[model samples]
Target: MERIASVDEIPTKGVLFDYKEGPFDEQGILVRTRDGFKAFKNECRHLPMRLDDREPADIWDPHGRYLVCNSHGARYRPDDGLCVSGPCEGSHLKELPVVVKGDEVYLETDKIGGFFNV
Candidate 1:
């Protein structure tokens, strides 16, 4: 397991990208949803392009409902990383297995699925 970010760094309703320089490889995100922290690959399902153009938390839709893909307006459910509406509808984001211990967020690097290819 690799600690990525502290729980205080991520808001309860915001998201943050784990830079490549961190313990994890490749671009990934840690979202603080209503339920709790959820992680996923930063790549959009449409292509290898990144999903957020700016800060991850500011890339939501007009109503600030879903996570909107800045490149294509692909709205995804932060709770499950599911693309409910967009060119890639029905597809889902590659979720990362994460666990929060104390005040730090960590990812089970060794258990990352092959879909990430990290």
Candidate 2:
């Protein structure tokens, strides 16, 4: 496991983090939701691109209830990473395993295998 951020570091807009998946450098998104903390790869299911690729730091829609893919207008649920609208509808974001310990958030690197195994 690798420490990513503190619980307080995650804001309503969420936080972006960097991690290593095998030999590749990847990014992750950590959001604090009503159910607790959720983390996912900073990627859009419709394409091999970051959701905020077109708009830096602008990953949320006007209402802030869903995570929007700036490049394609895909909206995803922060709690489950499900794309509910736009081109990627019916698709889900790649979820990353995270654990909260005390006041810090940790990325379960061991659980980050599968497609990221490389």
Pick out the ten consecutive residues of candidate 2 with the lowest summed lDDT.
109-118
C-alpha RMSD of each candidate structure in angstroms: 4.6, 3.3
Question: Compared with the true structure, what per-residue lDDT tens digits does model 1 show for residues 28-117?
Answer: 777877777888888889877778764553566777667778887787898899999889998888888889999988877668632232
* Model 1, CA-based lDDT: 0.74
Which lDDT tens digits does candidate 2 get at residues 32-94? 889889998999999989988895558988988999998879999999999999998999999
Listed in order, each prediction's TM-score against the native is 0.77, 0.91
Off by over 4 Å in 2: 113-118
The TM-score that candidate 2 achieves is 0.91
